[model samples]
Target: MKNIVAVNDKKQLASFIDFPHDLYKNDSNYVPELFIAQQDMLTPGKHPFHEHSTLQLFLAYEGDQIVGRIAAIQNNNHNKINKTTEGHFGFFDCINDQETAQLLVDAAAKWLKERNMTSMIGPVNFSTNDICALLIEGFDGPPVAMMPYNAPYYQQLLENTGLAKKVDLRAYKFIAGDYNDRSLKLTEAIRERLKRNNIIIRKINMNDFWNEVVKVREVYNGAWDHNTGFVPATDKEFHYLAKDLKMIVDPDFIYVAEQNGKMVGISLSIPDINQALIKIKRGRLLPFGIFKLLWYKRKIKGLRIMALGVLDGYRKMGIEACLYGLTIKTFQEKKYDYAEASWTLEHNTMVNSAIEQINGKLYRKYRIFEKSI
Candidate 1:
């Protein structure tokens, strides 16, 4: 008998967090998320997202055995900002049973509808700013840093649940030597031009991390403002993410374009610690798990070209090329093997085309789903 229990208390919430650990226990590609970090994000008073939006967690059980889990989210800010009453379901997991999936989603839908949301669109626990998409493709390997992963059967289960396809997001991949040598050869010229303008690329000053992040936040929010359904990350959310990434951030790959005095552009590449975490069992880091993390972190070779942004007036004039080049240059200097420039909108021709210029090939796709209530 499968029962849905609301994760209403400390015990239930802990179970909600732990369900994925058990589910992916034997899966070698699974990365154990940092427990303390997960705790802070899910805790109401601890996370800023909870101040404007809300989430309800549900765990499915078959007579004391945890079978599955889901997070029902009411993003009031999204509705208010977009003027669309769309609720979200995220943190989804299941046992590949149709009934179990249905019950979990049904409960999420019911909870959202009670809040007067007219339709449902997700797998988005909070928003796109976080790891919100389902792994519809690229499951042959472990997920990259901060990216989501799931079994391929999840697509069948979601479709069976009537969560129709909404939009597909893609991740473009590049092998170290395979990506065009043009970006490689032009690195010198690009740096020369930027240097003439007093714009140099350098690692973030870790001693001044907060002030540095504040400046980057301005550019980050401004850069992605035009993307569909993008909500500028709140201070807490951005800081939360920055804190997590800081652990793996390579100073050389975190480049800032400063001219004279003002910060104009930025590009960030994180070592794909998913390479290491893929070995972490169910995201746990305790009881001997920490050794795997401590030892294997430096062995990672893959990188994720996670962010590149320039201010509006500075979009053209080769700033994007410089940022991209600096990142690849750093990759070469550090001897990283491959990278993924990901989650580009299908309609974003400019960036997609730019990535292609560097020989990035479309290798993975993730879809965001929506349906009218």
Candidate 2:
């Protein structure tokens, strides 16, 4: 008999976190998430998300064997901003059996319904700001840093349990020699025109990281406020994320546009550290894992253009092109093998057009699912 149980103790939580490791053990494309990071994200007091929201984890088992896992989340901040009492389900993993999948989804739905949430939406580990979505396309290769992956049957599993497509997110890939340098060639002219308007594009200063992050937060919150499901990060949340990102962020790939010393836009691309993380067994970073992380980091050949946005008044001023151009320039200089600009909403035509203009191929697609609880 299959049974679902709440994860209440450290042992259950460890099992919850490690379930995917065993499920994907023979899959070459699977990359285990860092254990400490997963622990902090799930633990109530450890992650800033818990300060304004709550999540309950569940594990599905058949006798002594683990079969599935899920997290039911009620994000107060998301509801407050979006004006919807919609709960979320994330960190989902399971065997290919439809029965086990139904049990896992039912457990999460029951938890959300108890909290008076009328609808369920996700694959979002927390919110749109974090790793969110199911791999609906491009499963032939390993996922990039911060992207989620799962078995091919996951789509059917959720659909069978009544979840439907809420939205599709796209990931565009730019191979080193495949893309044209038109954006790079126009960089100087774009900057010259922007200079006339007193707007200057420059690299982020690692020495003044705290101040730079503050400016980035402003642009980040403002630029994405109108997006489909965006929620502005609180001060603590942004700082917490900034602190973690600072360790692996490359200065060359981070850029900001300033007008009269006030930040108006920002773009940040991070090294694809999955290249290094894939070698760390079970995502442990102690003894030998840390050494592999530090040693393999320099050999990484790709980046993820994680964020690029301009505030309301700064649109159409060539700031977007400048940021993209500078990023491509740096990618060329470093001789990286490839880069992926990802998770763009399917309806975001302007941004999608810009990426396509630079020859970014629509390589992968992911989806978020929702259901009425």
Candidate 3:
């Protein structure tokens, strides 16, 4: 008999987190997420997301065997910011069987409906600020750090369960030797022009990271406010994220554009730690896993251009190209393999054009789905 059970105990939650390892055991492209991180994110009182939002995880079973898992999420901040009573489903995984998938989705939907959510949208783990979307294309390699990945049939499974495409998020790849240096050549001239306007681009100051994070937060909130499904992260949330990113951030890969010392644009990237993470069994960072992570950290050869944004008034000032140029320049100097500028909204033609101008190839695609509850 097939049954769906709410994850109410530590054992069940562990099962929920470990299911994907079993499901994708044979898949070469699968990268295991850090188990400790996943645990904190899912546990109430552990993650800041749970301080303002709620999520319930469910596991599907065929007799004694686990078949699937999903999380029904009620993001109070997202709904309150967007003024929409929509829920979300995330951490979704299942077998190829439609019956198992349907049961898992139904359980999540029913939970959200009970919370008075009129609609559902996701694959969003908690919110857009985190890992969201299902990989629908570019299954040729493993995902970078903090990106989501899944089997190809995940698209069909979710569609058959009644979710329809809400948007496609694009990931553009820049090969080390494949890109044009027009942006690089133009950067000096752009800086000269910007200097006439008293604007300058420089690397982030690690000594004063807290203050810099505040300035970047201002730019981040202002620049991305108009994006689809975006909500300004609360102070606590942003701080929490900044604290996490600080551990892995490379100063050379993070640049800020400022005018008279006031930041107006920022670009942030991180080494693709998934290169090391793929070798960590079950995402544990203890009992030898920590050594692998630390040892391999210096060996990572790729980066993820996680974010690049400029405040509204600052657009078209060549800040974009300068940021890209600086980032790509560092990548070349360091002899990195490639960089990924990712999760751009499909309709964002301006940013897309900038990426394409530098020979960035649309190598991966991810999708977010929605359905009426």
Candidate that would win on TM-score:
2
lDDT of 3 at 299: 95
Once superposed on the true structure, which residue ranges of model 1 sit more than 4 Å away at CA? 195-198
Candidate ordering by TM-score (highest first): 2, 3, 1
The models' CA-based lDDT, in order, is: 0.84, 0.94, 0.93
lDDT tens per residue, model 2, 348-373: 99999999999999989999999999
Instruction: For candidate 3, give the lDDT of residue 148.
Output: 94
Candidate 3's residue-wise lDDT over 1-373, tens digit each? 8999999999999999999999999999999998998888788888888888899999999999998999999999999989999999999999998999999999999999999999999999988888999999999999998899999999999999999999999999998899988999888888899999999999999999999999999999999999888878888889989988888888999999999989999999999989999999999998999999989988999999999999988899889989998898899999999999987999999999999989999999999999998
Pick by lDDT: 2 or 3, better one: 2
Q: What is the lDDT of residue 273 in candidate 1?
A: 86
**Candidate 2 displacement at residue 228 in angstroms:** 1.4
Score candidate 1 by TM-score against the native: 0.94
Q: Estimated TM-score per prediction?
A: 0.94, 0.99, 0.99
* Model 3, global lDDT: 0.93
lDDT of 1 by residue, 272-348 (tens): 98777766665668786689887899798999989898888878867888788778777777878889997788788
